[model samples]
Target chain A: MRKIKDLGEFGLLRELGLFGQKLPEGWIGPGDDCAIAPKSGGNLAITTDLLIEDIHFRLSTTGPRDLGWKAAAVNLSDLASMGARPLALTVGAALPKNLPFEWAEEFYKGLRECADRFDCVLAGGDTSSAEKICLSVTALGDMEGRSPLLRSGARENDDLWLSGEPGESAAGLLLLEKGLSGGKALEKCLRRHLCPEPRVELGLLLAERRLANSAIDVSDGVLADAGHISERSGLKVLVEAGKIPMSRELCACAAKSGADPFELALGGGEDYELLFTAPPKNREAILEIGKGLGLGVALVGKVEKGSGVSLLGEDGREMEPKRSGWSHF
Target chain B: MRKIKDLGEFGLLRELGLFGQKLPEGWIGPGDDCAIAPKSGGNLAITTDLLIEDIHFRLSTTGPRDLGWKAAAVNLSDLASMGARPLALTVGAALPKNLPFEWAEEFYKGLRECADRFDCVLAGGDTSSAEKICLSVTALGDMEGRSPLLRSGARENDDLWLSGEPGESAAGLLLLEKGLSGGKALEKCLRRHLCPEPRVELGLLLAERRLANSAIDVSDGVLADAGHISERSGLKVLVEAGKIPMSRELCACAAKSGADPFELALGGGEDYELLFTAPPKNREAILEIGKGLGLGVALVGKVEKGSGVSLLGEDGREMEPKRSGWSHF
Candidate 1:
């Protein structure tokens, strides 16, 4: 396990910068008082997210670096969902009295690393005292000339697609909770859960190429997130259960824990994968985008002229999961 | 007190829009993914702040509308300190479990009100669950083709000035904490404490006219925030006790509480006024701008070729306040 203090503040941020590599159009990519990005004709994209201690993470299970990374990632994910490129981030942190300065520095390092990776800079933020640590990150992005891809844009007959493997984060969470480890494979899953990557590059590719009709990030499980698309688009979506992708490590863990891999794949959260839809004509173009970016592209379902989301079981029956995944409130 | 629930989600935002009438140059003012602003021809000005329950405020005392207002104001205050004009804002809210939907609506109403007042738009944000309510707001601003006014810009022999009354918010807080209720005067002070308005217009005027050599908002307190200027600029500032302006209401409350008005004015936080310095030549211009804005401006101090901040006591002796103000550790 990596301790946040091991990297210090600046060191951790340096690591985060490594992951955020692509720049969206019109953004002067971070490292300033504010990020300037060209918007829909000159409009900019801005979003914020807040994560609380105990409510958002437990220190015993999560490290400071991961917490900081998650804070920025969640906000950036919102920008991605809107088809915006991240430019700058500002953070507000409330630390408990007992928190060490070194810990705070490490936390900032993680945040800086993540911001730099996306070519975004840590502009400025507020710090204060609290009984528990709390973090809030606001991400700014450029919209360029593209219309933001909203959750409401999926029309009837559009094809729904996902950017990468689903349910891996949830599987990692399950493994962490049970104290079960499977060496390198389990390590990868657990890392995915703790430090789920935001699909900013893939989102930008879709927006740049005008391939996605609508897009969303799978933060709260495939079923629930897809439900958002269904509700907003006023359309029905049929997802084939077997077609949902799962890592082999996740499958093995599910089998060992007596959990259904398919169920986890559908109902797990924190995947941070891009879930989008487009016309059938865009299929080949999107696939080519995936190949260019070295990301997996999966066509999972289709949009129909009705409301609600359904699942197709192996027996050719429509099925609903026992739960609808996680909800903030 | 206005409850956040009184306004529906979108209604509250609409109410907020009423306040955002004026916009600075090169700003894609409000209502997008992010606010876009040009700083120094190419740079941008960004800042973020977070407020949480039992940390920044208590619901029993502070109204939800005020919370929303303060969240945006604090971030805007940071931009003002940098001599930047408000552009756009993003928010991240974490609501408690079993939270009423109306609470969020009312909060957004307050947020919208503040943003609109500052000509800022609520761009985009994320909402999630928490054990307590948390708000994180990030404000983007334009530097108007000039370098941002950093804390390091003050030079020796510069004249120090303050816009509006100081320490009213802190005085207001003392009254609230002591549960000391007076008449309308106390009520006014309490309101000031609850909702400290950021001096955005004045800041812009100063920057536009190039009247200030350096600037920062009176957030942490006069002495502490001035200390940032001193540390960064490597110059000492001698603040005149008599020159520090106080609202009549604040003075009256302080007298009743047997508190030193000067001490409160120096060490109390959340004033949200602009504290700036300029060469002696700019004095007339500064005064003219203040008059044009109908704002009360005062010459409070002078920057000297030394390090540290000092107060000129009535006895002609240098005095330091017992407390330097709030420190977020």
Candidate 2:
């Protein structure tokens, strides 16, 4: 009879996972970015994200459209990591009665924009009134005959590749928190924070071509996501902090604001970038695919015969990393 | 630009459904119990329900196990009405930091029980801390090649039927609110409110055998659900007050307490009973099936020409029913 506060989010998940096994046929239980299930002999990937006010966002700063985009984006990121073809999405919103109808309309517009951008359909969901805004988006996708990339498939010598910018979203959050408005520099960071683009095309290419051995989306920072791959694959992940991808805008803003760029890239969360592992044989092809898709691909780290994650600085020295992710407890 | 409060829940849905209709292959949008989608040429029924504290239930009255049960049951009922085989479920929860650990464990236990009872798998979900306890459950089901019974399929002159005891759950809620405990008379009612059994078997039987023309579970009372059928099918539905089957226990309790049993049957929500329409030729077969399943079956109404729902008193006079259900504004 332990309390939830004592157990923390991860502890509770571990406890819940004890019962998550014993999945039915056509279904694989929890432990991945999304749950993969066979529907009528075809595989479908499903993922869900819970966005809460104050914990994940504040109404004062978050607009209606951005709130909706981030909600769908977070779940879509999980879908992207699985290399699943987007199909349908369902949104359950618990909002206050005083919330404007126009706000909901704008929210749907954003949600629909993200869905339509990836050619996904917005399906059905339930709505209710609550004290604070709470949104839960469930995104469903088709595997398109290709096996989904999982967090557990990395080999001992796999090269870890990252797609898209890391830490820019967090840097944007820092800027907003400091009440710094204006400048083209700040707008890019703000967009990263407010609306993220899930790397669906890159994930599909990785899975379809069998390039990536393992995959995950950067939601709770790169270090945390890499750690998930390490824990699940039973391998050590060593990330070269200097090699972590950061947009030029993010670098300039970080330097100007007196924040360490490497630290921000290592520990800033909610970038929605794809962090995946591929064997050396696929390196050239992976780069070609990334370029073809117009996404930046960086070989930031490698998997080894060990456990947990370690970050190495440009000087080949390890620095104490900031704890990644927000603990709900 | 209408405000959400001004538009009400139905209007917002109408707006959302504007986009919902543009679904991908093998998928039908909103305006029904669940969204029907094709996966590998077979249809999957997807439905979601949002349960919020104080709005859907109270922490003071509901134990965590019951909370989980209701959350799963409500969504399962939607799946049941769609005549889908329960496959997997996803739950997204928003909770307070100080919530008890025992409560969460108990909640999972209850969720597992319901899933196991129906041979459904417990998939993964996302959890976060919020201002109040809120749960969103998405239920997925396999329809097994049979055309699902939609709410809009009722033919004119169809015989409407009901399974199980109506108003029992609401009666139970009344008992709990009035602080009435420890009586056999109240035990049945309380159990109905606290733990509702989704009529999966009956719903499956109706769909598999192609007996039911239209189906919906009684969640927002029988009248409101009937309205859904009428609105979708564009046919007049007449429900006789006397035919709405109530248990003998309910009759005795209602008479003793001077409560209107008929009103309770029509307006009391969360009954989780299957209310469906079948042709006259299928009535005998339906009763046989109900008898085999050990469930009560009664012909309670009829669908005919015209529109909207009309309730008849025992004397054959029409009565204006009280509009029940939460209007999310």
Candidate 3:
């Protein structure tokens, strides 16, 4: 008789996930933002992301345009994780009755700005009245002729790669929550949290070159998301804690706020970066791709023949973390 | 400086509709659930619909299963309007944290049931927490080499045909609101209000045989939806008030509740029925298609060389309705 809140979001998902288990042939995953069914000749990847006011964000900390941009960005980030070229996006918004028309207009502007930047179209959506704002964005991507990078494709002995820094977004959220502002690093973290970019180009490059074995977006922090790949692929993902990438801004902000940088980097969520696995042979190529995109790429971990995720301290031993990651419920 | 509430949903849509207007080539609409781009050898139609608790439905009157069914049906109805064969659907839900896990299970069951019946796969979705339950469903359909039936294709002198009765859903809602239960007719209205069947087969038939010139599903009431066709097609839709179809259940429920059946048929929303325009020459064929599907079809109006929607009284004079339609705002 436990409620969903007691079960938590992941438990509820696990319970309900049994329904959509019978996916069509050639489909990727209910586990990895499934390919669903093939459209025409190309594989189509679709993912929906929901953001509720107060739960996912606060109107006080987040502006209307940034809220809009982040909404689209998060959904697109799902598409990017699958190595799919963005095609179209639809937004379903439930806004308060008293919301300004100008706010909505700016929201759409940000949505379109992100969609346009990612070579996707803002096709259509629904608008409704709600007590609090709730936005749902569904993004569709074309895999073209490339095979979709799935979370279940990782293999033992594969190198685990991560793009961009992971902890800045969580650090940025902390600063916003504590009403701490000022300083260049703090401002950068705020922007990182507010306007997180999707690695669409890197995903495409990986898919095109057939470099990645498995991939997932780092939304629920590195530990939880890596655990996703581990669970799906039935392999262990071991991360070298010292190798975890943290931006200069994140370190600076963590120092100023007296927060654990490693904790934020590992367990804090809302980092829309990509974490993927590949053979060590492709390491040079991936590094080249990252350099081409002018994005920070790092070799953070390795896949082994086991299960779940583990973080190793600088001493090369397992590290017990205070928190693993975030759960919506 | 007007708020969106003052602007209303339609007015706000008009104001913010300027962005995303420059759709890629071969795209059908920002107007008629636009085919943003061609996929493979077919046209892809996508639409998103949002249903918020208290605004779109009341948890007291609606069960979780029916709520799930209606959420899927409304989106499928949009695909039906476009004469598109539904391919897949993604649901984005923001549920109250304290909701029962069993409720979510039943909801997914109903969602899958409707999607399965319509030959659409429940591919993927996002789940999050909110104060109120808000469901957003995005439906994808393949036109399969047939030209998408746009809302702008209705021409002058075309016969405007409607499938099934319009007021039943509204009448059903009336019954539910008043908590009037008992008689078979009243029960039917309540069922209609709770569970609506999307006309997927009929839409496919219309598209496959090229019968409907333009079409739109009536969610915003027949009069309001027909107005969409009229405005998009650059033609006037003249609906005979007397010809507005009402089910036997709706009539009985209206009489007992002392509500006007015509008003309910014209302005009461959530019909989820298809209202379409076809050339006069195709009337017989269209009727035959309806007969084959075992669906009720009514030639309710005609498309003229004008704009907007007009309801003519039995005396052949234009009648002013008490309300044009339901607005979310």
Candidate 4:
């Protein structure tokens, strides 16, 4: 890929323009000062996230396409966590002086792919020069008269669940570290790590049906993400170690690498899966929604009256995890 | 100042909790997974901007407080140009590993002051480590039943106008570069440059009343900013150079420094003023609104039948300005 500097400023924008196409619902997309979308009621959900080079991803291991995908995914995940329908996004990119044009083009291509898949429009954004690459995306969504599912809404006895398998991304990272080529399934895992899919549709379904009491995206690993809900809701959470879903391929890969699947499941970051809590009565409904959406749903544990998180091991012993998840600071 | 690293991840958020003050109606201020605000008929005005160290501002000249203020102001300015009312904002700051904690606290203090002034709330944001300082802010606002006032809305014969004086920032920059210090009047010019107040209320009023034919913020200098409206609106803008407002202090400082005041007025940036165009019929209404707000309004030009921007000098001769203004690339 060409460096971003080769594209200059206007050139980079022209490159971005190619990827930003028409939206699914005739929504005006990127290139405008800001995007406009119709909301069910009168409220709009907004969220922003920043991805710094080296800090968020390494150029050597992650491609520009993956970087772009992840940048949008992180912000979209935030919107999804709120149970808002993704509508539009604006990106703020700070490119290094020596960046190549092709790199930027590929980056936007990846971002466009994600936007198309989710039926969202690429809205306006700002671009500037920096010492290193930094991408900040702000996503806008429609709430549609539903109360946003917040991290502070989980009640005691609420069943905790995740949208998909937890440890695939971590397992992929381990394989990459071991100098293993991501062959087929391994590539899929690596892609999952680098370019996570934001559970937008599932989140909308959950909100539409009023099934989820609380929700958060798992960018900072399961333990840390769950910890966020626990801290916000003033409740304790207990995870059944054996019940946490793990992909068969991921388990095999973890075993081969002599890594603990449980540890990765607890502390690995960048999963981007929706971790949510719902009442016991809503279990079947949530399961049906997940099945209809083709999204994996795992019954991980339950919310309790206390504070902090506890792990119940296979031997029926409670243990505190060695560490929480990734901390940005 | 305590170093940000000392606060860790959640600790930093805990620190942010101290600034969780209430906001105007319909604003769900920061702290949740995402921010939500009421929009006019369900449409939102959203924008995101990033300020990188050295690239956007120098720490030596700009204080932490002003840095915080300007960071929010830039994005707020974008929303203002769209005629949106300030709602809530989320900040993402990447601090250098060595930054002290007190700096962060003071930064937030300044940010809080500005947010309060604008009736905005400090929503949740992210903090991380970087080699140099970088701040990214995303602002969301409500349009309140009006179509966004875009740069593409100008038409021929429309009168171009601006709020307040121009070139203050440029004059201040010159003074700072020359190490000139300490006159009360000079200090005002410097403060204007350092902590620009976005014309949010004026923009909102103009949009709500449908008074502006086109609008843009004076961020990249009048010529360049006007050039955007010209290009987007496909209208020729003939700016009357002698009519552009200039503060007496700026004029005197420029004269003392043997600099051309016209050049400064044309090419100086970061003024954070509103540059807009309106129909001749709406001129009286706009002037009344300006008077009601106690703000200065100057009619500087008229839209023409063609494209591109031209300036009429003091001698009634058209002249191309030497500087086009600041370019981020």
Candidate 5:
């Protein structure tokens, strides 16, 4: 057997790949954020995420409260991707000794508030002191007997949809980087960046209604998330650049920063919007849901027979953007 | 309200404690490593722990494999405390870019080996880059309809038992710190420190047989863990110092290091042995289970109608140690 040292991280992961040869029925192991236990009779969805200081957030702009909220929100986003209803959350934080204890309290307050809003319990967590602050959060959800929305389920010609505006958080981040001195547009973007809400209800609605064939959260950007769906489903995602929903606030923030609003909407990350695929027949019903829920749900693209992701201009011309999305690795 | 800074981290936690009064049935809101959702038909126990570089372990001494094993082991120890059967694990690691990829692979390999040994699934986890290597693992288990053993369940006159030697890990750490130059004795202590095995089977037996009233894993040494039971159960734990089980190897290590073996057994942490309380009448049943499992189970003390923990020296004199056990914060 080859030693893991020679294989590298990804390579070793590939070799250790879920130990698929031994998995039980309904067990979806390691590759996904949330693993489904088939033996549970299909009632659980669990997901986890890590957020480190500097890498995940800049202390200059984010305080403990925002940090706490974002920590829970991101993992909740992963649950949403699985079309899971939040039930409880477990948090783990490593703080520096000099950190104001009050700051940690503020962070918990934010986490509590988010959990409350989601009707989830802030069940348990471990806290310790470290050289720098880091957070790990796990969100557990009830599948309610519904099959999860997998990234690899899109059928040919399935319409791509967005639960809300994209790239707002990224735009907000740019504003934060520029100094939080902008107008309402920048403030809105900043809030979006600081506390991007996950589309839990929308995800639940999709799963319950059996509307979405494939789904993922737009944490890494629309194009990048779409890539996961494309690669997993073995189909091409033809994104309509003009069709991606954008708030006037996002546009104004982009304008002030001299950045392209469309590009921000397409390639920027951390919006926590639901990016999903549904059969074209369900478009009307999905749009009705958007109206009923008072949340924007727009058709932004379609799944094609080919593979990978391609963008189309309003004029129906294929265009290539500068980058796909943010990558932690 | 006073600022959190005024409250300090501990006060802040106390203020934010559990959020239990607000939780619904089947919800165990915080305060424990694994929170039980009583509604899961009483089948689940969930727990998480965070380990950071320099604080939890020195990267210079601990290779990635041991780091991974310890990360999983510590959380598993928590599950053992609850008498929950290991089911699945979700891990989140923040790695530095400069970290050798091979190290990460070795870490996963160790994680895989441990999970496999325990019949638990390494279901899923997230990986990201950070300034230092940090690991967070969440262990999910099924309690199998057996009520969880709480740290607060001990009653007056309940017999306290230790599954194995206490402070072996702590002694091992001392040896490691002193440099493992002694003979097999030092090597044994070092191994105990680096790879302390969790008493999962014994915990399961106790829970299943109703042998223990309150149980906890000795991660922070017998005194500290007993203190948890003492405080929670609102009773005094009278530990008989001479009764604490210690190996000949530990005595040798202590002689060389000039440390008291009894003190090391009492105050050293990370033994990962079970410290539990049981009725005196169940001694025969407990002994039988121990014999069946071929594991050591020795009565170390008794629970009394008081508060806090007090140690009686070999000569029956009360002794107060300078510290309880290891504390991360």
Candidate 6:
């Protein structure tokens, strides 16, 4: 018999998508960062994320504050992918009865801090008892009359752009798993893994300037998310591994741990950076916008007339990946 | 030394409320059924509910289809409490890896059925792996330029009205716990427990006519919910135990189980009925509206200028409750 493990997370999501297709006019269903629902005069973009203890985080390596911050940031990153302005968020938590009240206070403190930093309000939520800690954060944003940046809008010949560095978060996780944490570089990687920063400003700016044709958050690795754009847009995404940007911390951590940086960069998940496709003509403007926000923008690849994603090595040859990305199953 | 269990669910919620007070203009935060966010043209009401396996329901008693339906219905009931018209819903679920694919298909079928029946759309969601099944359903509704019916709006001398009987679901739960299920009465209670119908129609009518001064859904028992109204409105709620409606199915189940029917009627939960307050002068109009809708509306209580909730017995003497309601902690 086919089980959830056999179908896998992506397969299960694909099957679930069939049940939500008949949405209302101007409404976008599953498959994007946030679902779009047209309200009063504008569109409301919403996204939800579920995080389970041990599956997503371990208390030994993660503090309550960081856990809460990451939970809210991940959902905000979804809104950012849609170029939606932050508005509000609701958090539903299932906490173990034996958990200390101080842990909850610290968690909410961190969650509120993140929402406040992003100019979003803490809305409402539900709390219940559970044997394990479970969190569900739902974030709502406003489109402000602009069309949402969907994954299915990447045109052929569009340049693939990524904000910030990838692989640092995965490298940090490896370090934590190994119980090795010290030095400035390792500390930076650990921080990245614990508390990811959502590119909300760049997302809103891109939408305001109409810069990008397609966008997605780096929750499922750059290659896997690029595959999403390919499947939705019916185009091929060719990513140049040599051109993928890497942080110094990630490189140091990889060298110390005897791991390949490219593998982590291409296959690791939960970076919360924005990956987008834009017309080649807007490269300079996009670069300038990134500079204005003090963020780095890397041109990694391009869209082509085909299907699936391909990783080209420095030798201009396709490289087979050891692992594509993290799968829940 | 204080743990979540010591604080209890309500106490924890009260503490959480402090973190959400400084909201934007025209926005309501954590104290209502759904947080109210002023959108482009009107207000949007959003509420989220979390259901954990064993904590909220046991897999031995609940089928996958019923679990999905109940999850959606509970969130919709919260929206109904605000008198908001249902718009869209997002579901976040964490399922064990060993679960069969057919279970998911059945679950989504029931979830879609309930959402479709209420004119709501399934927009987007997240799914992950967990040790036990955990479901988080977030529902959104539109106020359509009308003021929301708030729990804090009950005025002195207002009549407290309840739609539908309140004890059937709890009685049904008791029967299931006792492994006793059969006959028409027990079957009816079981259905009520499995597939609860939200008071959407009655809520809309009351909001449309401005007939309700305050409103709340009966998820945490009638007395506890009335206590919420009293605390929020800074008034007193007085309920006549004899006037509280009791379903024949609930009575039969309670009698068979050797449980007190009045205790279940006043302090049991998960009924999804609307407990609202209206002016004494609007009693006839409210009764006519209920008759037109083919729904039974019973006047069982009153709001007075005092504090807290008080339950009066058949002889007009205050009755002390043995247990107020379900407490997560």
Question: Model 2 over residues A214-276: C-alpha lDDT tens digits?
Answer: 999998889999999999999999899878777888887787678987778888899899999
Q: The CA-based lDDT of model 6 is what?
A: 0.89
Candidate 2 lDDT over B10-70, as tens digits, reads 7778876643466666676787888987776568898888988888888888888887887
Model 5: per-residue Cα lDDT at residue A60? 75
> Which candidate do you rate higher for DockQ, 2 or 6?
6
Predicted structure with the largest TM-score when compared to the true one:
6
Compute the lDDT of residue B82 as modeled in candidate 6: 90
Single-chain TM-score of chain A, each candidate: 0.86, 0.95, 0.96, 0.85, 0.93, 0.97
Ranking by DockQ: 6, 3, 2, 5, 1, 4
lDDT of 5 by residue, B1-329 (tens): 35334544345557766534467866655555467865444467888888888878887667777767778888888888888999888888777776666677788878877777788888777767777778889888778789888888999999999997776677778777777665888888877877777788888888988889999888777898899899889999989988988898889888888898887888888888889999999999998888998888999999999888889888998766455655466
Question: Candidate 5 DockQ score?
Answer: 0.46
Q: What is the lDDT of residue A324 in candidate 5?
A: 65
Interface RMSD of each: 13.8, 2.0, 1.4, 16.2, 4.2, 1.2
- The candidate that wins on DockQ is 6
State which candidate, 1 or 6, has the greater lDDT: 6
* B263 Cα displacement, candidate 1 (Å): 1.2
In candidate 3 chain A, what residue range of length 10 has the lowest lDDT sum?
A28-37
Q: In candidate 3, what are the lDDT values of residues B56-79, reduced to their tens digit?
A: 888999999998898899888888
Any runs in candidate 4 off by more than 4 Å, and if so which? A1-42, B1-42
- Using lDDT, rank the candidates from best to worst: 6, 3, 2, 5, 4, 1
Model 2 reaches an interface RMSD of: 2.0
CA RMSD (A), model 2: 1.9
Local accuracy of candidate 1 as per-residue lDDT tens digits, B1-329: 34223433223333434123244455433322123345334446776666878767888788778888888888788777776777767666666645444455567778878987887756545555666666777777766565566666798899999888887778888888888886877888788888888888887778777778888888778887788678768999888888888789878988877787777788888888888899999989889988998989999999999888988887778876454755343
| Stretches of candidate 5 exceeding 4 Å from the true structure | A1-22, A39-42, A320-323, B1-12, B18-22, B317-323
TM-score of 5: 0.94
